[model samples]
Target chain A: MKHNFGAGPCILPKEVFQEASQAVIEFNNTGLSILEISHRSKEFEQVVIEAEALVRELLHVPENYSVLFLQGGASQQFAMVPMNLLPEGGKAAYLDTGVWASKAAKEASKLGNVEIVASSSDKNYTYIPQGFSVPSDAAYFHFTSNNTIYGTEIFEKPAVGIPTVVDMSSDILSRVINVADYDLIYAGAQKNMGPAGVTLVIVKNELFGKSGRTVPTIFDYQAHAKAGSMYNTPPVYSIYVSMLNLRWLKAKGGVEVIEQENIIKARTLYDEIDRNPFFKGTANVEDRSRMNITFVMDTPEQEAAFLNLAKERGLVGIKGHRSVGGFRASVYNALTISSINALVDTMREFEEKTK
Target chain B: MKHNFGAGPCILPKEVFQEASQAVIEFNNTGLSILEISHRSKEFEQVVIEAEALVRELLHVPENYSVLFLQGGASQQFAMVPMNLLPEGGKAAYLDTGVWASKAAKEASKLGNVEIVASSSDKNYTYIPQGFSVPSDAAYFHFTSNNTIYGTEIFEKPAVGIPTVVDMSSDILSRVINVADYDLIYAGAQKNMGPAGVTLVIVKNELFGKSGRTVPTIFDYQAHAKAGSMYNTPPVYSIYVSMLNLRWLKAKGGVEVIEQENIIKARTLYDEIDRNPFFKGTANVEDRSRMNITFVMDTPEQEAAFLNLAKERGLVGIKGHRSVGGFRASVYNALTISSINALVDTMREFEEKTK
Candidate 1:
């Protein structure tokens, strides 16, 4: 058994994997591999419907919102959000929390005027910026809710008077959020949802066509909503596997139940970091992420030694982003408390060895 | 034994499915689900490299062309082709063979001026238009190589003298093609390549960054090519499975061997359609697609009865598109000669029952 702490394209339930794997061979006893079935077929149409419904239920998304399963990841959404929301010559306010946040602002700037309301870039994005006001005249306020690389997250949706859009790619479905608070929420479903193909977009229906730009039909949210996320052939197997994982999430008592487990998991690992002498947490204490827990050692040699030990014990994907050297154990919703214990045990083992 | 005749998201080799399903559970003995591994990992980096290499080997793609595994299907490419190739105020010429072809032109029209050099819509797109002159001044000439819905195909690349782009969504790897002739060739992997979610783009390196328009980074071909399709986390499992399918294709003696099989399979089915008194082929004989074979009965009742008979014989997804209002048997590369014989035998059984 391995404890996978990879950030994005990360772990899902073993049950989900078993079922998903089975479907690749024979889907629903339909005498067809899920990979080969037509996206237009009733069976696949139901997969999309159920996946959408699960998102709505898990997040408590309002009826006015459209849940879309799209492609191209959050990188595509960076451009699409601006294209669909920022009108010609309109300005959009952005809070740059990390690389992803900065990229979002940069992409938006290409379409129209963009104002960086706040940025944590000065300190290598170690914390989410605070006490910054979003420009009221801006068409929309955009921010990254979770910074996977920097090990920081903005838990509270900023009370900006303008429409709010958040990139929840790393932390979506791991915790609860009020869907009504944001005009749009987009996430690449690799982190907590399922895998690395489909993107989840939950946008308020009223926000449609507000940009007044000739958005490509494929990029337009309204076109996807009107067509029920079947504007064209969607990532069929990805969406289908996502549906299976969503079903798994729903069975595990939905997001509320998972949120409490996530809190415990983060706290357990963070407690070990605080208690251990050889290791140190990187993010500011107040803004430390509950998903990706970044940490480092006093020396590169020590860090490498710990990583080797972690590997010997079946701990994989704990290496940190190059921008923030050391280790990042991404403990998403699917990661169990036992895995947290295993990591804590390893950290203690490292301390004992060092002593 | 089910013979899937779905137009797209169609069949792949049984061996590919077996290997793909196993990888999902435990990818390459890594003790991690394929769905969970980090895209930045060396393991997955190898998957992308091998997939690209296999494509180059199978298609005999020149070193000057970059093979990209992208998302959002060919629909996204319809816009990206224009965004990347058609300069601001420049004109692109298009050949309208069916819905997909027209849609491609329509998307391009939004980005720059598009000229419909020719269209076969006069005969309900039953035939491919010939003797059309493409404007020499156009930035690019775009056409759909295979019309899945209309059951028509253009096997030859028309000499247009401009940057030629073809959407070979349905017939890409079923036969050999000169990659040097076309400036850009894209195909949704569902038909002849792999499954849905991932799209294959073989673009000449010289065509990059010539649009003179500020294309979104995600939509820009140069960005994708430079990053080696790792511009963002690609559809991981989709690409992995495609690699498996491509490996299967290579092991089965590459495109040359499969082309012969496809030819024999198509001829066997088309022969049955021609000989059967109760059925008639829909598309023009000269332009009939080797991949998607469309045909119809004289009456709706007869068509319905034949469809029922086909389903009973474990032949699925043979029902044609509503636009064509007939039966469309999509015999992709993975579809065996036995499947063709089964479809033909079913057609003969229908004729005998009717008599």
Candidate 2:
């Protein structure tokens, strides 16, 4: 059997994709394609409303927080968060974890002043910097929860005194968190939640109304809040599929249960890498991600051989990002424990063959 | 048979959605879910490259033009077009045809001097304004090609001496046009295309490097152009479904054949409205849109009864925008001729019963 470890647009529950395929043809027996349904209609509105509520309930978001199914993914939010939340000429603090954080910092700098509080890029982001100081007077502090490429994650969310924005694009819903602690949290749906079109944004209502900027209605959190994420034609199919995935997650038990399974999956593969001398892991062990596990062979030649042999054995998408040349096995929420075991077995087989 | 007349997030061809649904699961038997496939993979990259080529081929885009897939819909472009293309303190001539045009004007006004060349709002946008003049030294002349709410369209695109930017969100790909005439053309995918979450932007390459403003990377057409629309994690499912729709359109004899069918669909409904004294067609005949046809009754009683009766008979989503205070039948490209024929039959039955 083949195991897909593609770091995202990554694995999704088979049942969710199946139900989504069916919905595309006949949405709740409406005899109309989901694509054709009006966003404001009773049926479609239920999707946005229920999806929002589920996100809030699952994450334990406070009543003051508004959940939005926005378009443009987390990359867009990198700019929009600063644009709508930052007061004109305001300064924001950012932690440079990896590529995503760097991109966020660049976009935020365009709208207002952004100071990089700390960066692990000096060591090629092989680890997440700890104990960074956020500016007291900044608009907000920003950080990426997980570095997908570098295979590092801040297991514990940093404590920022001021309002905070976290890009949880790669690791959201994989585990439970204190939703009330965050002022704004956005996740691109492609990785752990759903497909690629929708970005889930949850924001504290009170933190807004301070920006004093005329944000384009599409970019404005208040506009999305009032409309319940249906201000314009939303990513209907994507959101519907997200609803299905969330439902699946709830059925398998919510984030808390899934977090246990995720821990088991990550540990199984990491143990194999640690005990086996044939493969060397990339990121610092303490800062390693439970989702994306990056590793390499003892030599470049062995790495190439291992990749080819693994592909021949139906293990696909194990190649790491070019910036960090190695192999990465992304075991997201939908990644079964069996898939991780298969990778570990594949690695063991490679080791025996090389020996 | 059920007929959907949603203004947009509207109907697509039955086969398009079916094929798209299949791809979500298998996607060329890659054994990985489409969601699991890497965007950098040759398989998915080919999908985007081919989609762009198909768009260019269908539009007969000039060699100087490049097709790009973007996020946040046309609403985002309302600001981005000016932000990336409009030089600092430069004046842009805008013809406000309807709601969308006014939105574009509002966004452009934020960046630079906006000269309102003409406005059809004097007639509540029920008729298109004629004999408009563009500023001789304007940056570009911007207008909405089809007003979804107002049911007015520029049947013949106006010639502006300066560069022209047209929001063809509603009627795009339904009719043929000289793509080279406009410097930029953008269309949201939900209407007459495939789905939400993807916006098609076809722009003249020469138009860039003229704007002095340091636009955010996501908002810059050049940034997307350089990355071939993979500058960020694109709305993958949306784009893949769009490719399916485009392929289906091509298989069904391309735009020319579909355009004729759209004309027949519009003429059928418009003819019924003109013959029935109970109905009053809203837009002027010369400016009436072939896509969105708006009409109303003399009394609120008639309007309420008509809507309820139609709903009972499996006619869904025909209600117009509340701002317009009437009914609208949006005959996008995928809307079958038989659907319009059924609506006309329904209209006739209603008129006879009332009389």
Candidate 3:
């Protein structure tokens, strides 16, 4: 079996895939493919309801918060967050962790004034910037909780007095979060959630329409919340598959259970990286992501040789981002311990061959 | 045999469904579900490229145009169209035919000045308004090619002096059209194209970046076209299935062949509607949509009775919009003429029993 270690749009449970695949042929015995059913139909309405309920139950999202399943990835959210939160001429504060974080800030700057609260760019984003003070006068504070490219994660939410927005695209659902902490949280549902078409948003209801700007109805969070995320024909099949994946998560004892397993999985692989002479971890020791584990070798030839060996042993998608030129084994929620063991074994084999 | 006539996310070919279902489990023998594959992978890149190529081939799109597979459906396009085409303080003309048409105008009004060139709302949008003069000074003239709810269609493009844009969400690919006639042609894939998560946009290359307003990068057509619709993670499975559906259309002799079948299918059903004494067509005869045929009975009791009979005959989603309050049979590309016959037969059966 192939061990998939791809970052975002990553692996999902086998059972979830099977059930989703079956629905594509005939959904809930409705005599219609899930792809063909009307989003407004009672059957599909149930799918959306259950998907929302699953998000609520698993995350313990507060009742005051609205959970939306929207189209356009987190990239779209970059613009939308600023449009709905930052009023005309208002300033927003942002922390630069990596590419995604800086991109978020740049989009916000196009709409209004933005102050870079802190940045880890000095070290090539090898760690999350700490002790940054968000301006109290700013409309809202925005940051990326997990930097997929840099393989770093913020375990603790920054307590900024103003509203806080976080892009949790790569690490959401792999670990539990107190949903009440952040005023708004959005993630493109490709990694720990489900697939790519849909983005998940959990926002405090009170935050809706607070900005004086005349946001386009489609981009307005209040419109979506009032309409129950059926603002228009949502990413139907994407939402359905996400519901299936969520069901699988619930069956496996929710995010808390998954988080424990994730810790062990990351530790097992990182231990090997530290112990192996030919390999080295890329990110800071404390900030190293439990989701995407980035690493490298002393020589380019050694890295190339290990990648070839890993491929021969059925490892897939371990190649790192071009910015960080080695390997990134993304161990998401659906990645089994067996897969991690397979990678560790491959690394050991490489070391023995090198010696 | 269930004959689905849901407006959208509507029916697709059984073969396309089978292949799409298989790919969800194991895409292209890569040991990864299409749902799980990275959008950046060569495998999925090929899926996007092939989908774009198929659109170009089937639509006869010129080299001067770009075919984009995007998320957020036509609703997102409602905003993007204006954002990309209408410059700051520029006036745009719109034809108000139905709910979607009016909604498009409403969204454009948020961005800039929008003038209603013509409106059929006076008669509950039963006919496409004709012989209306578009404002020559307007940046663009927008209209709905087919009104799904009102059962009306504008078969010929109005030669408005300015740029022309059409929302072909319900009828795109059911017939052949000259792509160069309109500056932009967009369709939510659910109806005739593919599924709900993705939307198809065929836009002229030169039209990009004309809007002087700082359109958000995500909403900008030029950014999407430059990146080949890969500026962000796309609706992967939706694009894949659409490619499969397009392949089916090509093998069945392309849009020209489908158009003939669609004409005959519509004619056969309209013939029954006119011939039958119990049922009466709703839309103006000359403007009745080939995609959705709306009709009603004299009494509410008669309509309810006919609906029950229709349901028992294995017909689904034939119920009309709540506003229309009768029946609407949406016969999209994948809907076989045999299914149309089933609907016609059901209508005939109702007449025989009532008589």
Per-model TM against the reference: 0.99, 0.97, 0.99
lDDT (0 to 1) per candidate: 0.93, 0.88, 0.93
C-alpha lDDT of candidate 2 relative to the true structure: 0.88
Residue A160 in candidate 1 has what lDDT?
Answer: 92
Task: Estimate, for each residue in B184-290, the C-alpha lDDT of model 2 and write its tens digit.
Answer: 99999988777888999999999886788887787889989999999988888889888888888888888988899888889989999999998989998899999
In angstroms and one decimal each, the interface RMSD of every candidate reads: 0.7, 1.4, 0.8
Off by over 4 Å in 2: none
Task: List, residue by residue over B255-300, the lDDT tens digit for candidate 1.
Answer: 9999999889999988989999888999999998899999999999
Summing lDDT over every window of 10 consecutive residues in candidate 1 chain A, give the lowest-scoring window: A127-136
List where candidate 3 sits over 4 angstroms from the true fold.
Answer: none
Candidate 2 shows a clash count of: 0
Residue B82 alpha-carbon offset, candidate 3, angstroms: 1.2
| Candidate 3 steric clashes | 1
Q: What is the TM-score of chain A alone in each candidate?
A: 0.99, 0.98, 0.99
Candidate 1 lDDT for residue B351: 81
lDDT per residue as tens, model 1, A118-228: 998889999888899988899999999999999998999989999999999999999999999999999999999989999999999999999999977999999999999
